[model samples]
Target: MGRVPVGELSRYLLAGRLSTNGCLTSFRRTPRSRLVGPAPPTLRPLRTFHAAKEQPDPTHQQVQTPPTVPLRKKLKDEAKQARKQGKKKSNADSQTVEGWELTVGIEIHAQLNTPCKLFSSATTSFNDDPNSHVALFDVAMPGSQPIFQTGTLIPALRAALSLNCDIQPVSRFDRKHYFWWDQPSGYQITQYYQPFAKNGHITLLARDGIAPEDGKSVTIGIKQVQMEQDTAKTLAHNDNTQWLDFNRVGAPLIEIITEPELHHPRTAAVLVRKIQLLLSTVDACVSGMETGGLRADVNVSVRRTDDPSQTLGTRTEIKNLSTIKAVEDAIIAERDRQIRELDAGRQISSETRGWSIGSTETRRLRGKEGEVDYRYMPDPDIAPLVIGSDLIAHLKQSLPVTPDTELDKLISYFGLTPKDALSLINIDNGARVEYFYRVLYSVQDMIAADDLDGEGADVKTYAALVGNWTLHELGRLTSSKAGPHGTVDLTFAPDGDCAQVPDAELSQLLYHLYRKHITGKVAKELLMALYLGELEDGVRSAIDTHDLWFKEYSLEEYEALVDEVLEGEDKVLQEFATSAKFPQGKLMFLLGKMMRAGQTERIDPANAEKVIRTRIESLRPSAA
Candidate 1:
């Protein structure tokens, strides 16, 4: 049977369905009218539900909620309804048509954390001067040969293992021939045929775009992880002359391919960010998208959710997406494009596209290339890469604790809530995580050293307090927009170095807070002092210098101060002591005056409230 126009099919299906009596009533209630287009013989629905089972049981006689309509179908139905009603359609309605379920898969290229290139000894550091760190082998010199960097494999292995991939026993390199101005070698070395690892999955929690019933996790499948060489950078000169920076030519990269398991564009973006944080925990990649340290290529397709077979439609590849926002925007735009084509009875072309950052639309780059087109051949120059059991075992032992594991440990061991634990980890930026752990262990050390006050110094409580300070108070101080200098000083050390604030100083400040020697406000001031390098002698010195130490007063003295404030303001006391305002707890307002008169140092708020309430009851004549 030949394909029919979508418009003709829609009109015929809708008109003929009304003749079926109640059979079409259910169809009308659905977000879209079902199409009876000819499907391929093999493309049958996977399963069928009986009509009796689909509808509610007659005995119950209760109304049942219809299944949720796919987003695409809902859009199309709304558009059709607007047209029939002679109303103007909104821009969103004009942008999309119905009946498509979007599926997205992402391929990520992460630059490895290594001192040298993958197949050469040349430095891989970014330099101000172009071509300064190039090796003869990088530029394809006649006599220079490739020597593999075995040390560089550690970072890649750690990444694959952390992602729960199975490391292959034997992997080999292949030459992908491509002629470009940036590739002096005329080919890239990659593990195309037999990659290093494969078959992994990640569970994405519904932290965003979720409803009460939609709280289940979304698991995405990983296809493979392969080691590859990065391309050189091309810089354009003033006269349109192009210069190549060979410094990055042989740099290491790990390419991760995922199955088409993502349904929403934002979900895809969130998964990419999670992967970035995971890799950062192991130092596998620098995890910076702006500097080309990481990039993603998105493959998007759409299908009919109501179709039984759920056959995937033709897919488009969006390449070199450098940011998470770009990934999401490109996928949504491409999904809309495909739906519009299908609704008009046109087939989507399988092609590679580039995302125009300014317009946020995709433009065709080239027809999508198949693996056969690359003519992949085994690299004769390099031997087959083999991993012995002993080496694999050692690498597994050396793998760092994954971020998810750390989150769990923070919760279970420290008795912290999931929110507080996540705040301590700070997945997007590990600076706060670093500070948290440093202070945490430092406080523990001080306790072990028998230096703490030892009365109310609980490790779990201190850990929670540290998380609050780091994420809340310290977070604001360091935030670029909120800070006084337009940036918070997160500088503990320079880039690529392990910089942490002094543990001794941090421990002292934590002790002060735990012992209630300083309020939370005063604790923040102490942290600022330490950050600014003004707390040279330690927490005590900072407290003295800033006059932030809490002042202690005798119990009798505090009671006298409270009595004086209430006695002096007789009218204020009468209003609070016996009026209806007493129910509103207006006595605390006058108690605040007593604390303020003593500089808020001589009395703890809790103690002051208890003492002032007793004094007020005596004045009420009930105590007499």
Candidate 2:
């Protein structure tokens, strides 16, 4: 009888070659091991919180009786049953608030925007044919070795720097073992004991779009920013059999772990959004949660709000929450569930859960996997990665400003209000932010060139106006729902609803407003025409072609227009007059009717508003 190594038994077992009779089954090279040496008694010490656990040898395993409930396949059957019979349909069991404080910590896995797999030359592509991008190492072929990718480090470091993390001088990879079809290697290579970077903090300020009114700062401590390879994705829930897609396998990933400081679900959501922006800003990762390029795992627990000790409760993790909305909803549901259970004198179990889109609640995935369950061990093949000071400095110097910094700069430098600043920076669809700056500078350049013609218009006022028009006029057209999704550099769109907002055309439109040539209403018309791809003739030409230039209306014309509006909307005018105080809303409503009755180009909004108020006051006294 030949001795079978306990550590290598899983490989043979998975291959259906291992028998209780105990004949040694082996390979020429055991999965990339350069030399196949005699098997040792054990791989290493497996640590447990309670005691050191012994590794089980397959030959000495005891056969136990089967359980009552049948498991055709552990993953498949459970998911099938769950989908067949939905859980917890009672709306009457609504979440009861027991004053239990919720604590949430999140682990975000963002796929780094790299050209190739982390340790293989296989190129990365989304929604590609299955196994199309796979390398020998990705499929865990025997004798295949991991070739360390230097390209991944640039983006990894960029991610770390964006989060204000301290880079570790040296870091090593570890193996997290789990026997699953998705991970054919049986062990995922990751950074565990020593990660790439750590001790980072992302401060969420009011301007960071988290707490706009609270005026308080929330600093989320990043425990670790580790570079890891993603596992192959498995599609099992909707189908009877498991389907493995290896395209995503061995893709570069950066796992960012945050300390459990977040209490509110909305803040947790904002934090995720902030991190998403940061990663994208630094060119580290493509932050598309819907596309599975980015995903989050929230570790949530509830504690007594009034408790003096402030001890954390037993936590259950909600895994792979794809959207920020899902992250918040899952945390809220989980916290509520725990509160309800505690109120009923039931213990909250620590486990891994999944978010059900249909039920809109957290469902149990499995028992919580502890550190011992993972059986982490350092990779023997890969050497420890060392980051030189020069490399760190080089990447640091090139790091772009994160979203929050850019937000502040827009407010302070461009004189944009926080509301307007947020609107510009957080446009989901296009490069409207860049479009804004381009138009701003173009108008400013025109002002600089023709100082006498632009006497009344200052650069700061132009900046404010530019921000306004970009958000309202420009952004209204080039929205996420409507595209010319701003794919090309300066050219946003060729011709569509969200056509290209060429700086020259937009700047000329603004210049007309600055030069007192057109009212805002007329300018908006021209802006819409630009959206219709009519700006090819130029803003100046369109204004000339349509006779859309501004004209001054006399006091009599304003009064006549006001009187015509009053006669048509007499009921609304009566409503305004009957109000105890001056109804500014009603006054504006009437003013809008008068302007739309046809004289937007001649009637300035400010003068028109003044005339309407005075006329309304006169009418009120006469009616009295």
- Find the candidate with the highest lDDT and give its number: 2
Regions more than 4 Å wrong, model 1: 1-99, 143-145, 206-214, 356-359, 415-420, 426-431, 447-456, 480-488, 493-501, 545-548, 557-598, 612-624
**Candidate 2, which segments miss by more than 4 Å at Cα?**
1-98, 209-215, 235-239, 453-456, 478-499, 554-598, 607-624
Query: Please, what are the lDDT tens digits per residue for candidate 2 over residues 148-259?
Result: 8999899999999888899999999999999888887999999999998999999888665553322478889999999888988777756588888999899999999999
Candidate with top TM-score is 1
Tens-place lDDT digits, model 1, residues 406-443: 87788877767777776555433565576677777777
* Residue 135 accuracy (lDDT) in model 2: 94
Counted clashes in each candidate structure: 2, 0
Error of 1 at 414 (Å): 2.5
Which residue pairs overlap in candidate 2's backbone? none
Model 2 misses residue 384 by how many Å? 0.4
TM-score of each: 0.74, 0.73
